[model samples]
Target: MPANEKLKEKISHLPHKPGIYKFFDDNGIIYVGKAVDIRKRVSSYFNRSAQHNKKTLKLVSQIKDIEFTIVDTEADAFLLENNLIKQYQPKYNILLKDGKTYPYICIVNERFPRVISTRNKKNDGSRYFGPYPSGTTMHVVLDLIRTLYPLRTCTYNLTPENIAAGKFKVCLEYHIGNCKGPCEALVDEAEYNANIAQIKNILSGNLSVAKAYFKEHMAAAAADYQYELAHKFKQKLDMLEDFQAKSTVVSNTLTNIDVFTITSNEQCAFINYLKVMNGSIILTQSLELEKKLDEDDTDILASVIVQLRQEFESTSREVITNIELRLPLDNVTITYPQIGDKKKLLSLSLKNALYLRKEREGRQEKNKEMSEQRELRVLETLKKDLRLTELPRQIECFDNSNFQGDNPVASMVCFKNGKPSKKDYRHYNIKTVVGPNDFESMYEIVTRRYRRLLDENQPLPQLIIIDGGKGQLGMAVKALRDLNIYGKIAVVGIAKRLEEIFYPGDSLPLYIDKKSESLKLIQRLRNEAHRFAITFHRSKRDAGTLKTELTDIKGIGLSTADALLQKFRSVKKLKDLTLDELAAEIGKAKASILYAHLHPAEGENA
Candidate 1:
């Protein structure tokens, strides 16, 4: 059957239910998508009457087969699609490259739970809250918790058996009143757990519960005529109110709503999510997604809503967004407010997204400018050091490589404005030299390089560096003299022993300051030339070895052997690999052929 007919038949049989669908060719999955109606969405790709973009058309043409999973709702489909995309990383999916991990407040799961800030979220039965965007805000909340409840900050095991056996002592934290001496059994477990319960309430944005607990205690202290204790409780209550006042409250009536807004350019989309609880903005997160196709802001926003909400474990009944999104969420209200506080919330979220975009762009621009300025400064310093009439904006360094006078090769590395211009780099095999003649090889390559440049009417480099002492520099100068361009370009040679610089027709070597930028740049050019030459020489030698050994195996071509050598570096290394490891690099069929040839004893058993 034809590939298109096979795909069409598969799409025709899809059920009309909400689910995620995957498009695949012979290699693997290429695209993953979520839709409310699987049959309609899959058939739309094959519908000739509908207008489709070039990318969509290309995707449809390449899809040879289709597979889908039925789900109960669109929300479930979104979740499944997100997970599949992450697992497979299909070629045509909007990549959500998550940023750095934010700090979460963790309540340690132990006999006496300790509250602390952590960046790692492990599933160890411990509770985590507030991947706070602002470290300052998180620290402030931590301080409030510490002042309200004097929990232990130490990591002592604090097991019931250890505490009962008196295996621990009170630390300085207990003396400083930051801890209630839980390690020494001075604080009862039930009372300590009660304080932990209240701390949980405060961290969850339920400050009213904590406040009520403090107020009731204050009243009890006043009834017992303990004025000083009651005064301390009053101070705690006042601190709670002050903290609440500092929070950015949207409105007293609004509760348990999430606001999401999107700002995008041609390449990427930035979405900001704000979680509002009890009329105050409690959490804020911004996500950056790299676009794969021509998806509009509304579609991207809808997908991101599912992603961020699931990550933050948001259970808000209402979702407010800047654009109109028709997600089939059960009993959930999607609002696009026009003229109310909800509108302001949406605007605030949009402002955040725009600010994030502007900040990222501005940072990139500033870094580019700084890099250009630094490069210009380095070039100027190098010009002064070399005493050249013109700045060496283009510098070329050459080095020759050989192993016991075999597989001789030469490499030329170019640096433009004090940075490596890899596109201008070139490698050469020795054509005229017989064996291990560095001087003659240098002369041949130098003459050939400049002769071709002159023949092609290409620009010449301002400075040339030879990676050896006076002998190599003299050969390069002889080559230029033969070409009648000896006085046109400046040439120098560097000695590896002392990093001494040799000029043409000079007897003595010049030494610049050890820490000078000019010296560093010269050293960088010399090292890069040596590395390039050695790499080329090894590749040539490895190719010869593979031709003698690996080519003996049937169905293994030079390209495959070269690829294997480039990765594992040698036949010994490749021989040690399992069949599965080889399959991962090359295909299973080729891997089996090679593995069987390499390990004939093991192959016979199989």
Candidate 2:
């Protein structure tokens, strides 16, 4: 087929809506590009441009065909483009590789759903909230959910047998009353379901109902002469009220509607969607794109309206009643409701979108400024604290863990330009260290990490951070010196509390200015490293304790064990299956054996 004809054929299927498109070679090699109207964007390639760069001309020439995804808005298109380019590493795209996945809060669908941090959103029965601006923001919401709701975070399936056998114990969350101990049968199913209902209500911004219920409970407790219980209920009620006050209400115009606004500049576009349910703002979402706008504001608004209407048709119960845009939306009833609640809601959403755009721009500027400021501060602080000559652009931190010096493990986390470079994070199972020998463990970890770097001719870090005092710092320094890398890498240590910063040879630790941004950056990095190390350690510990009832089944070998575990993440889930269900899930013979073990009455043994 002729190239232009082939391109036209590809463009024929493209939606005349807002989205980004990609150009690919015959070998499926990608060249990323963005456009508000994908059909127009891809069609532009066929246009003869005299000023085209050699690379661009070459890319355009080799482009076998183009593929486009229709997005709700141009902003959504941009974000999708960024995500795809990051994933595919297209040859012709400007690749700024950052090893960070946008964080999402996934509420897993199960008997008792868990709210946890995830990077991937699959078509599972779960609801995902975010692409949070930062981990801190995600954590704050997660923490609030944990505190406010009696929800289970455990992946363990709760069953009657498990509760009776005491196989499922009350977790720390239960002790603190964050969980209602459903696993242990301490809370009835009705009450637990009620709690879940309240959580959903809270998430949907029905704060008044939750607050009112708590107040009623508080009054009842007070009348019943239970002052402590009454006080607790009152405290909870107060917290809900405070949360309601802080929330910026976006709409009172209508319930169950989403308002979308798109703002575009030459370099990037921003699309913000505010979800209004029951006349209150439930959630707000924003997307940033790398598409340039060519059309007038009204035209852009029209494109957004068409695309959004399509996307919403699949999810929303009814068609959108109205669209409020910066410019006139021709087909829709584009009434800028003046002087009432509807106006206030529209104004709030627009303001939010603009504020978010400015904030994002400001953050980029601040990150650049802070990077330079931090470089100087790190250098000056390292000079005084660790006797280093310059600031470190890259810092690698090492942490070691062992349970009473058994199954010793170590991890190395990296920070580049004051942000975590997760791609460089490394883990080690300590081979050389004995029980309680943290100093030796530190040495082993450092030496192994740097030795590999040396073998690969990789760049050495400007500074090495150990999660210990002078002794641990000294161990790391000695390891570097042994590798003849001591001068190349400045070594420092961070001790807990007193926030003491230790150096290799210094007897006393140094302290940075409490309010310094550099110090805050270091603290954040240090805490993340510690958290990662602890998580790894706990996972190792859990793996060691992993037991399966399926092990008793005669025919169930390693492969079968793996299959069963994959099908059912926990033994409780496996135990929940009947003989027929097991047969459906696995196979007949395997199910027979499992049934014999679980329900002997239904087995051949009976």
Query: Candidate 1 lDDT, tens digit per residue, 84-202?
Result: 97788788888664555768899999988999999899999999987787677789999999998888988889888899999999988899888999898999999999999988888
C-alpha TM-score for every candidate? 0.68, 0.43
Model 1 — which ten-residue stretch has the worst lDDT? 1-10
lDDT of each: 0.88, 0.69
Please list all clashing residue pairs in model 1, or write none if there are none.
none
Among these predictions, the greatest TM-score belongs to 1
Per-residue lDDT of candidate 2, residues 1-606 (tens digit): 334665777777787788777777858856766667777767666665565656567777888767777778666665576667667877766443445566677778777677788877778888776555467767766777677677887888776777788888788988986788888888888777676667667665576677878889999999999999999888888777666655555544565655666666655556665556666554555655553223334444444444344332213332221244432222334455666666666666677667778988899889989877866666566455555676677888888777765567888889876668999998888887668898988889889998999999998888877888878888888888999978777777888787788866768778878876656766777777778888788776654433345665687766777676654556666666667777776689987877677666556544
Candidate with the greatest lDDT versus the true structure: 1
Could you tell me the lDDT of residue 395 within candidate 2? 85
